[model samples]
Target: MRRSAPAPQLAKAGLEVLGEGVADELPSYEQAFKAVVNVEVAPRATVARSAPGASAEADRLWLEHARTAAVIDDEGCFLIRGAGRDWVRVRRTAHTALSAALVPGAGSMVIAMSPDGRRLCALTEEDDDYWIVVHRFEDRP
Candidate 1:
């Protein structure tokens, strides 16, 4: 049998968790990331929530991507309906807050989307490192 060393305690605590039923139709981060064909890292660190420039950044992302793609926010993941004229929150098994890693001084989430609106992803800073969580839409929203 091949045995691997146990993960470090701090690493375990810093892990980004995509909790069960982020949305009934949304697959786990692992499964979605596995099927991803492309990735684009943000050019700079994302602004922290409630911090200066944060709202601007959010607006830019929302206008650029959320208009065509599904969105994942503090409330959980959901899709904009009817050509972005309306919205529908995805149903989840439990109410959960979608957050990044829980490390001190960690920057806010940086988001990226596919032009085709088939994928959305977020990068969370973890101390000096970063963790990327991806969500792939099997069909265009």
Candidate 2:
């Protein structure tokens, strides 16, 4: 399979998981759940305009957001929610496993495997249809 080059510009956009963030330590199931549950989207993202001719091309948008951000404390972890379709995504690297962070489901949750097991991601309902895009997850330092 072919993969896109790692994005260096994402850091400027505040893509924390993709940049500035380091590999975080593994967390217990309980810790992961708490972190995910505690943090919410807080606010929604405004729609972005497409380049002149791409208006009809369709684009992805953030429909809703969890109120709190992913919480990280002295504890191990806090977020691990089951996907709706009996499928929960887990990412594993040669040395560790990473659980799915965000779950965006319209019909059902999509569970995908990371080629390197270093990251796991999900799609939001913004597609109008069930579309998914996942990325690697790096542990926070």
Candidate 3:
């Protein structure tokens, strides 16, 4: 059987992930992404206790896996969810222009996305270590 990746604790260290996964009439990645960020995937039945009186509630969160899509190109990025889940496509737009251009250096990773399906992607470059550039496309009327 395939092994599932361990649960990942949420951390906003320095990662800016971007991408799009929808078209004119589909449930796109941009939509899902808006609600998901610095996401923490927890394991089912895994007990986690916070402060006192945190309440002993049943955990509905399961350790699904956490990963950001690679910046494949200027057109889009790809994300693979749970098994059998269709590949999510993060489309790009003009907002991407600002994103791909802003990191600290050419080697820093840049992530861009729009609340709308305008532009969403992460531009990755290798600096001595690694840095993140973030941008989100805004659809102006």
| Winning model by lDDT | 1
Per-residue lDDT tens digits for candidate 3, residues 1-141, read 122221121011222233233334423434434423334412112222332321122111110111132223434333322112222333333232322233334433223333333333433333232223232334423
| Model 3 spans > 4 angstroms off | 1-21, 24-115, 118-123
List pairs with backbone clashes in candidate 1: none
TM-score of each prediction: 0.30, 0.23, 0.22
* Residue 77 lDDT in candidate 2: 23
Model 1: worst 10 consecutive residues (lDDT sum): 80-89
The stretch of ten residues in a row with the least summed lDDT in candidate 2 is 58-67
Lowest-sum lDDT 10-residue window in model 3: 58-67
lDDT of 2 by residue, 33-59 (tens): 232223342213322223442212212
Q: Write the per-residue lDDT of candidate 1 for residues 9-127, one digit (tens) a residue.
A: 21222223322222334333344334432355332234455556544453444333433444444443433121112122332224222232133364544333333336665545543
**54, model 1: CA deviation in Å?**
3.3
TM-score for predicted model 3 compared with the true structure: 0.22
Candidate number that wins on TM-score, 1 or 3: 1
Runs of candidate 1 with Cα error greater than 4 angstroms are 1-25, 32-52, 70-104, 107-118, 121-141
How displaced is residue 56 in candidate 2, in Å? 19
Candidates in order have lDDT scores of 0.37, 0.26, 0.28
